[model samples]
Target: MKIPGSSLVRFPGNDPKLMLQMPSGGRQNTENSQLITAATVCLVVFGILAIVDGVYYHDIKYKLYQDKESILEHIYHTVRAVMFPIMMYCLFAHDFGGVLMIVGIGAVSIDFIMLIFDVKEEGRSRNRYGGLSNDEYMNHVFANTFHFVAIALILAAKPAAAWTIDPSFALGRPYPQVTAWLGSAFVAGGVIAALLHFWQWSQYFSRKVAQS
Candidate 1:
């Protein structure tokens, strides 16, 4: 059937409604980007506030040194800590930003621990992850590992050319080439694992969507 004035055609059984419907993947991708952007922006704001409060509220109870994370806090410590190194990585190739990398990971670790306490790991959380098979589990693991690698890459590059580098910036730094390589390895390994998971999820997606 012709769609309009143009000669573009589709099968008689083609669904105009489904075709016109916005792509599911498109929506998901957009939302994911939005989530990341919001996360980044909020973390930046949180960091600024923390630095300001740490200086001004050094004696106040709400200083970041004492401030905690919760659904309401809107302060994503992990992102704030990581972002500094990530930005430096984008700027330079050495360990100048090492502090941020270490702090970021620590923040994430602490945040996760705090999260464990602040929220139940059941109900919606459990349900969201409930239907996973081995493949899905692997995929999740791989995806997260890649995420770490991506973050690492953005944190590890040096601030200047490698022809001349600083020893102080070497072995002890968080964004050392070694650590970044390890993170990349994890990303690759995780991708392989996630592919298997993707295969498993495909079956579920196909069944649920019901092509015909």
Candidate 2:
């Protein structure tokens, strides 16, 4: 006797081993994999650039966390920081399908909007420091470019079915070794970013109270 929804529960070809197997050679499949790989690389580069800008320039060098002028920027970072881990989980940690994919897209879209606002507010926030340095400005340009490119590549790589409203979930990596490493790195980075932003906000609040 077969169970209800057994088809949904079963792996491809009813073989559990095949579920985690990488796709075999096909031009389209290969292209899609390449796109995902490139997007992952872009994300990694973006992460490094963000660390330089946020940690080295903003936190250590300028100590923007205690400045009232930087409060708006801090607010933007705090929100995006919280969303980053969820976005990374949905994008890299698993093969999200249907509604989950939609959720991931929504998260990315919101982050993009936040990025725009963050950039827009930087002029006012950094004006006290004589605006952004050339190095920091160039860093933002490259990081933003990579971020947009990654989104485009991911959207191109996804199939039409990924947009549909079907409920499906699975615990598996996108690729074998590389994806595992990328996913772990992204998720860890996201968590750390979130924590750092929260700490910055706390420090800022403390400074504000002391000044009062």
Candidate 3:
């Protein structure tokens, strides 16, 4: 199934609706360049803070990552702590061509894997910590919302450069023929991630019922 948001940036030229019109001359260059700058700044600063948040929250505050019950959190944070910056670098430095697609696929794949570990950890956590406190939930909301907005801006600012299938492939440096295959990887990763989360949520409610 085509992802609702994927249509926003999926293979560039498939449908007119999916394709964003590129501004000509100075406008296009200005916007895309600005996007690159913003993406760079946000990725570096926020990414670093995110790492520190993990250390402070998980390591110092609760020691969750080191706790056996939170092994999933430990593993997920360890992997993503390494991978997130790499994806950001690929987008900022690589000019959002095939390299971005490659990294995007990797990000989604890592997220899917993390969700698996998360579900297991959640089951254990529910028994121990007893779900998120109001403040904790609010923090989650703020952090994730900020992250989603940053990613959205990056995509919106440079849709053509961001995706593999652009009509202006002539202008942007298209990747090798294998570039198309990366699209497939992107889709598969998203699907797996969605399914995994769906299953995880279902398990969460089931466990809640059993506990109650």
Candidate 4:
């Protein structure tokens, strides 16, 4: 019993209809659509929680930016801020193939490594505050869960051949309004993160000057 839509073929160019299709023009696989939608939803939640953690808890509540011990953690977030928009585009707004897909995968992989380092550094970073508070810790737990789930669903939805064939980077408006909204939000977040980092560094330098 051969599975329907199991044999994936690449559609040329950026036609919205160029997604995975059966050879005989049969019904398109709904599985990939479902998976992508699920992943998008997860990412939305992840983004919200991340903002709360970074902006509300870490910055406003704790002022981790002023802490020398938290510098490494902030560095991790700075890198993530730079990578976030690219990852969002590659994973959601744009369909990538061949070398582009490989590059997307590499970017996500690097983000994961940075996340691990950030998590490990959190202990030392938050030690002054008696470790992570219950609320912040729970926020991280949920954010990490959604982030990982989103990545898993994205990989599952993508065709294996996308990594090797038809090298293309084309608009993939899975949900145009949603994608646009997400793109705007992420771009804003990236900008804010950059500004916040600049502020952090300036404050650090000011303190050093004062001490000197």
Clashing pairs in 2: none
**lDDT tens digits, residues 66-133, model 3?**
34466556556555545544544443333354445556557746755764676456546635777645
Model 1 C-alpha lDDT per residue in residues 75-150, reported as the tens digit of each score: 3323333333333232223333234435445545654554344234212222433532454345434433544444
Error of 3 at 164 (Å): 2.7
Model 2 agreement with the true structure over 7-120: per-residue lDDT tens digits: 223334433422322233488677988888897788778878878987898789877777889888888887887777776677666666556667777888888889889989
Task: State which candidate has the highest lDDT.
Answer: 2
Clash pairs, candidate 4, are: none
List where candidate 1 sits over 4 angstroms from the true fold. 1-122, 125-177, 209-212
lDDT ranking of the models? 2, 4, 3, 1
Model 2: worst 10 consecutive residues (lDDT sum): 14-23
Candidate 3 weakest lDDT stretch, 10 residues: 168-177
Question: Number of clashes in model 2?
Answer: 0
**lDDT for every model?**
0.36, 0.72, 0.49, 0.71
**TM-score of every model versus the real structure:** 0.24, 0.82, 0.52, 0.79
Better of 3 and 4 by lDDT: 4
For candidate 2, the per-residue lDDT at 14 reads: 34
Which parts of model 4 are misplaced by more than 4 Å? 1-28, 171-177
> Which pairs in model 1 have colliding backbones?
92-157, 92-158, 92-159, 93-157, 93-158, 93-159, 94-158, 135-197, 139-194, 142-190
Q: Give the residue spans of candidate 2 off by over 4 A.
A: 1-25, 171-173
- lDDT of predicted model 3: 0.49
Whichever of 2 and 3 has more TM-score, that candidate is 2
* Model 2, global lDDT: 0.72
